[model samples]
Target: MENAQAVAPKSANSKQNSARRHRFWKQFFTYLYMVILAIIVMYPVLITFITAFKDANVQAFVLDFGGKWTLVNFKNLFTQTLYGSWYLNTMIISVSCMVIQVIVVTLAGYVYSRYRFAGKKFSLMFFIIIQMVPTMAALTAYYVLANMLNALDHYWFLTAIYIGGGIPQNTWLMKGYFDNVPYDLDESAKLDGAGNFKIFWSIVLPLVKPMIAVQALWAFMSPVQDYLMAKFLLTSESHYTVAVGLQTFINNAQNQQVVLFSAGAILVAFPIAALFFYLQRFFVSGLLAGGSKG
Candidate 1:
């Protein structure tokens, strides 16, 4: 009986030790996986940052850490290239798209969520169908339409396309968010003689600021990151957005200003990174809450 009790304690200790080892390995592997992923993701960004600061004479593609660093790449990027104009053009398009998209999507969403209008279900379904069609499929149509309107190379025209292309999906997202807000607030506001616009602008809009921030961020980033649509539409170098303008640096063998491209790429990140950091608090919550309904 004494031997049995002593063996039981030893067995219990062994089992506890085994469980601890298992947990240790599990956590170790999980952390290892995260570290591996972080390295993979940060590698390009790190290399780009390194290359952007390296001497202009150094081979841009070679990953050399010991090379002398200079600010000439950035200096040439702004002075030699039309980077300033491209940056301004891109900012205009992005900001305009954000403003217009927010206003249109918010109104559409509020109407869809609060009103019982004719063909509402059909319209919503139509929006889903529109969303299913890839933007690439409509590129030819866009070009043709732009040609017909003589609006090729126009920033306003490109901005309109960005705004219109996003409307259907953004409307659905906004409507889903609007649905989560209580209707009692609208009723209570009505009792105080609040008009429809007053209820929407004052009461409901405040509730969905997170989603609006998400929409604005999305709208802002669309033109900033997009290469294909801008490349296809804008023929003039002067009219080009930063995405297209930056491509000109490396589009041909003779024009391959790799160092300048890297510098421009780094600078391009500033506005986006700033905006993201500003809106990040709302970004995850907005996406989650807005997507919850739809």
Candidate 2:
């Protein structure tokens, strides 16, 4: 009887240990897969960053993984190029676009979410259809319009494109977020003698702040990284954004500054990477809330 009891408990202990081992391997493999995927995705950027500090030679730019490093890329990027002008131009466009996009998107969202007007459904559907169409499809028309207005070289013209192009999808996103807010809040504000605009400004806006940040980041980043529209619109080298400016390095027939391009790309990436990391919490939550409703 004593032998039988000991044997039964030992078998149960062995089963428990086997189950724990299975679970440990499962979790370990899952994490290992994720780490591998992350490395694959980031490999190019990592290589570019590594190449940025190396000398601008055929071997340094293309062949070697690691070698003697120097700061010449950074020095050349600043001194031999209009990188500062490009940075300033992009900053101006991005800031302006962000401000305009937020206001327009918020207003459209508020009206659609709160008020019912004739053709409201049709208008919203129109916007949804518009979002399905690629912005590049309208590039020719935009170019013609810019030419007619002589706004081809204007940074504000690019700013308008960023705001206008983003409005359809962004307004839809904002509307979805607004739909989640309780109508009771609006009614309560009204009972306190608050007007419609006042309620929207003071009561409603505060609740959707995360979505605002999301839209602001989108607006800013779109113009910052955009090469196509800026390329078509901005005629002068001085007005080039980082994307357009960076192209010059590769396109230069006489002196291809590949290492310098890598350095400049890294500089352009830093602020955007930092901003995304800072606002990531709000960004994910806002995306969830914004996409929750019809």
Candidate 3:
């Protein structure tokens, strides 16, 4: 019996050692994988930032920061190209789309949430399904329609298209947020002799500002960064967004101004990052709450 107890204790110690070793390896591998993924994800941004500061003599792939660094690329990007105009155009389109989209989506969401309407379920389902469809699938149709309206080169037309593209998803977001708001508020507003429009604009809209911020952020981003639709719709270089303007730097196979491109890319991230940071709280709350309730 003494020998048996001694052997059991030894066995337990061995098992404990094995478990500790197993856990150590497991955590090591998990952290290693995370580090590797972080590296992979950050590699492009790191390279872009590095290259943006590099001189013309430095190769794009050189990881050495001790080499020559110059701000000339960024200076040339503004002076030598239509980058300033492109930036202005992108801001105009993004802001225009954001304003129109927010107002329309807010009205639509309020109506859907507060009123009993025909084909409401079908409409909601259609919004969900249509959002799943890629905009590319209807690219030809949009082009044809733009041609029909003689608006192929018009900036207003492009902004309108951006607004339309953002509507489905934004509407769904607003509707999800509205679903969380209690109907008792609407009832209380009615008891105070408030109409549907008053209730929506004054009370309900204020309550759902988080979702509005989320929608506006998305609406603003789509136009500013969109390359495909902007490229297809706006043929005039003078009217090009920043994305299309950046593409011009690489079109020359013989002399690609990658340094300038990198600088421009770095500049592109500033507005997006700034906006996100500013709206971080509302954006995060809207996303999390909408996901849970929707």
Candidate 4:
């Protein structure tokens, strides 16, 4: 009996050590993976940052920053280039898209959430199908359509395209979130003699504000980042957005300054970073709300 008790204690200690070793490996691997991913993602941004501070002679990949640093690139962007016009155009387009998309997505989501109608499943299926089709496939068709409508080089044209293309995904996302919200809220509002639009506008809209913030941020960012589509549709340099404006600095005949490109990139990235910092909470809350329950 004394031998058996001693063996049992030894066996327990062995198991405990094995468990600790397993946990240590797991934690170590997780941290290692995170560090690797962070390095991969941040390295490019770090390179861009260094390029922003170096002279025209410095190679972007080199770690050396021995050359003179000047704010000439930024100065040109603000004072000499068409960057101001691009910024203004982008602002108008982004804000318009935000308002229109939110209003439409919220309405569509609320209606899909609260009401039962004919062909509901079919409608959703169609949206999924449309989303599956690549936008690049319809490039020729869209270009033709824009030209026919005389929408070339117009901000409103881009805004419409942004809003239209954005709806399907936003609709699906918002619908899922609205599903998590109890139907009883809608019913209670209706019981107060609130109509569909009223309940949607006053009750449902307010509750799903987090998703709206996320959607608006996305809408604002997409057109700003879009290069190919904007380049094709917007021919004139003066009507360009920041993304297109950045291309001009690269095409300069005298000096192909990587530093200028970097400075422009920094300027572009700052607004997105600032916006995300401000709305980071809403972004997290909104995503969690969709992933889990209401």
Cα miss at 193, model 2 (Å)? 1.2
lDDT of 3: 0.86
Tell me the tens digit of each residue's lDDT in model 2 across 1-294: 999998999999999999999999999999999999998888887888888888877453443565787988888878888998898899999999999899999999999999999999999999999988888989999899999998999977778878889999889889888888899999999999999889999999999998899889999999998999999999899889999999998897778778888899999998899999989998787777766754
List the candidate numbers ranked by TM-score, top first. 1, 3, 2, 4
Candidate 1: clashing pairs of residues: none
lDDT ranking, best first: 2, 1, 3, 4
Q: Which parts of model 2 are misplaced by more than 4 Å? A: 1-14, 62-70, 252-255
Give TM per candidate. 0.93, 0.87, 0.90, 0.82
For each candidate in turn, give its C-alpha RMSD to the true structure in angstroms.
Answer: 1.8, 2.7, 2.4, 3.6
Error of 3 at 139 (Å): 2.1
Model 1 lDDT vs. the true structure?
A: 0.88
Q: Write the per-residue lDDT of candidate 1 for residues 1-294, one digit (tens) a residue.
A: 999998999999999999999999999999999999999988888788788887767655755688678898888877888999999999999999999998998899899999998998999899999988778888998999999999999988899989988898888888888898999999999999999889988999999887888888998899898999999999999999999998888889975778888899999987689889999888677677766766
| lDDT value for model 4 | 0.82
Query: What tens digits encode model 4's per-residue C-alpha lDDT throughout 1-294?
Result: 999998999999999999999999999999999999999998888888877877666644555556787777678767877877888888888889888998898788777777889999899789888767766777898799899999998878778888888888778778887887788988898999998778877887778777778888988888888888888889999999888878887887666667777888898898899998999987786677665642
**lDDT tens string, model 3, 1-294?**
999988998999999999999999999999999999999988877888899899876655555668777899989888888888998989889999999998999888877777888999999899889888877788999899989999897888888878888788778778778988999999999999998779887988888887888788888899987999899999989899999999898789888888888899889897798888999988777878767866
User: Roughly what TM-score does model 3 have, to 2 decimal places?
Assistant: 0.90
* lDDT scores in order: 0.88, 0.89, 0.86, 0.82
Worst 10 residues of 1 by lDDT: 55-64
TM-score winner, 1 or 2: 1
